[model samples]
Target: MSLVGIHGVSLRYGDRQVISRVSLQIETGEFFVIIGPNGAGKTTLLKALSGLHPLIEGDIQIRQRPIGDYTKKELARTLALVPQQVNADFPFTVAETVLMGRYPHLGLLAVEGKRDLELAEQAMEFTEVIHLAGRRLGQLSGGERQRVIIARAICQQSEILLLDEPTAFLDPAHQLRIMDLMERLRLREKITIVMVSHDLNLASTYADRLLLLKDGTVENIGTPREVLTREQLTKSYGCTLLVDENPLLGTPRVSLVSEKVAATISKDSGEL
Candidate 1:
């Protein structure tokens, strides 16, 4: 059975329907990525999978059990979410913040055990944030804070991890670092990763399969080569795009074609 089963799922914010009927299966240890333009409900879908949003139409299952059947603590122990943005204003130290991931497993008194501290330390070390363990969360840079958030999720020790735009606003090096770390974690810990991202090339490179969402509907779902076609992207994004193979990875590489460049190419081709 699939690790996650999303069948005919739909959600809304008040009267506005943000997610139309969508269905997909994520297998165990798969790196599945959801990508789409803004307002396409990528993050909302992730929220639905994480059980943060109520489904208006269908059901989500984890490990063949209905998601709604699980209590909050049970769900927390089953899945971990790292949101796109975090409130770094908290004065808590980095270690304290990461240790919070163990709350679901703590006793009724909500006290951290030695095992929780060890897991927090291991998570920080894995994410390379051990150096900043004593520093305040607000004192770190964007990249550092993001890594810290990821560390917290790691410390949670959940089987499935959900991330929303984890690489947004990060530098290229930092972006690569985060992606690599996620890949490593997935391979080493056998974790199932479900991530929402806007970077087409990054998704193509890392994802085992990609789901393209457009205006609250599923535009396409397949491997990178099948979903990242010029026609599909141009239609979904309402802009001209150039699709080519990446020489290094042999995967699809997408490039935006501005009107000016499109016109220039059209003119040059006409003259030939």
Candidate 2:
């Protein structure tokens, strides 16, 4: 059975319908990426899969069980999420924050045991945040804080990891670092990873499969080559885009056509 199954799922926030009649399957151990323009319902779809929002229609299943049937603790044990942004006002140390991931596994009124400590330490090491173990969360840089958040999720030890624009608001270098770390986790831990991103090239490079959304509906779903085509992207994104193969990696590369080129094309087509 697929690790995640969505059948005609829909979601709404008051009068605004965010997701509409979407269905898909995420196989075990696959690196699946969701990409779309702003307000495309990418984040909304992810939240539905994480069981954060009650669906207005259709059904979502995790491990063949209805998502609504899983209790909070049961869901936490099977899945972990790294959100796009976090605000830490409490001055907890990095290690302390990571250790919190073990809460799901602890008994009622129980403290973390030796196993929890070891797992937290290992997660810190794996996320390259061990050196910041003592630093206060509020004092860290954007990149450092992001890594610490991921370490906490790692310590959760879930088989499914969901990330929402994990590289948002970071420099180019930090973005690559986080994406690389995610790839490593997927390969070494053999976990299923689902990420939402706006960067087409990044998604094309790292994802085993791509899901494209537009206006609360699925526009395309397939390999990078299939979904990242010019026609599909242009239609979904509502812009003229130039799609070609990346010279270095041979993956789909997307670029915007300059106004001059666009005008030339329009003139040649007699649309001027």
Model 2 / residue 209 / CA error / Å? 0.6
Q: Which runs in model 1 stand beyond 4 Å of their true positions?
A: 267-272
Top model by TM-score, which number? 1
lDDT by residue (39-123, candidate 1, tens digit) is 9999999999988999999999998899999999999999999999999877999999999999889879779988899999999
Worst 10 contiguous positions by lDDT, candidate 1: 263-272
Task: Give the Cα lDDT of each candidate.
Answer: 0.93, 0.92
What local lDDT does model 2 show for residue 125? 93
Clash pairs, model 2 backbone: none
Q: Per-candidate RMSD vs. true structure?
A: 1.5, 1.8
Query: Candidate 2 — worst ten consecutive residues by lDDT sum?
Result: 263-272
- Candidate 1 positional error at 68, Å: 0.5
